[model samples]
Target: MSFEKENIPSGVGGNMADVKKSGYLKKLKTMRKKFFVLRGESSTGPARLEYYDNEKKFRTGSLTKRTIYLRSCFNINRKSDGKNKCALALYTRDDCFAMVADDEETLSEWLQALLEQQQAGLDGAPVPAFGKCLSSQLSTYGKLWWKPKGLGSSKNLSGNYRLCLTSTTINLVKMNCENEDWEFSVSQITSNVGMCCMCNTCI
Candidate 1:
């Protein structure tokens, strides 16, 4: 990305390298301005609603956290009559902000932009990739079935079963059966001592 020295305000005086080191250049390159956006609303009414750009660089003010690194956001559903209005849930580590957009398309644009910024901010960080954080699962069909949670008796509980692992729980699906799939929380399960790292333990 090209950095414009003129774009930097007076107080933020320095060469491009200094600005980059301060992490201001990244924010400036991804700034987005939206119209009719409301900030901090409530059930009875909006607390402090206005069209504002948190990403904007000002000559005389401290930058808010949202302006620096907007991490993630989720969509809020409104009634059919509220079609033109779109609400979003914006979040940081210790803080969250609610925003309203004029329409779905506009909300989509902002969501994409903020997510891109979040990805960009973490591009060179020494953090694990998103895929590594997820748990691996295996599926197999065999004669080893079990009942779901809250079932006490294990008597005669063998049948065609399918086992799968998830990030949080283990799922046991009864093949060709109408019963609900059994789910075991990963915490409730234990692994044997000296287990191989290559094989994932099931609950």
Candidate 2:
């Protein structure tokens, strides 16, 4: 005996929707961790120091010119235990690249020298030869984050974000759309009532 069965239409659309939702949820979780939670230090460092690169190979001997921005964080006093952070965002045209720093004085000194070199218009001068030194400083509670401004939105969103820098800390604060307000507490750092300074956003 042969039996006939009714055919059911495939629910491919439903399955696709489920997959998309799951992917989105995973992305959201990753963003939350990146922007909110502090997961200690990241192990990645700057890419290999390259002076020049051909289509399929690297030209290590050729003198290459490029413009780069240095974003750094460091401590002010060499003996202090507190976290001090400062950043130098310079539009530099140079032949080398470097990493961030740990202590404030060392970072400041290196930045000062680089700025001087950039002003001198030296040929074949390294962009950031002090990268290792900078990295050492950064490993000691310093964090560096950068984005190509030309590739990012040109919107004037200063009202949506705030940056706080001190002899011991660097804080980036932004409004939370979910709560319709600023974050309750500033991450791992405690907000001092009398020491807090209002920025453009706070006003």
> What overall lDDT goes with each candidate model?
0.33, 0.25
Write candidate 1's Cα lDDT for 1-203 as tens digits.
11101121213421122121121111112233432222222232211112223324332332323232222111112212242245543322222244555557756665555444434444564322112211132222122434322232342334444444456655554444434346666765555222122223232
Off by over 4 Å in 1: 1-68, 71-85, 128-203
**Tens digits of per-residue lDDT for model 2, 49-71:** 11112311111222222212222
Clashing pairs in 1: none
Give the C-alpha lDDT of model 2. 0.25
For candidate 2, the per-residue lDDT at 25 reads 7
RMSD of each: 17.3, 22.0
Task: List ranges where model 2 is wrong by over 4 Å.
Answer: 1-66, 69-84, 91-99, 122-203
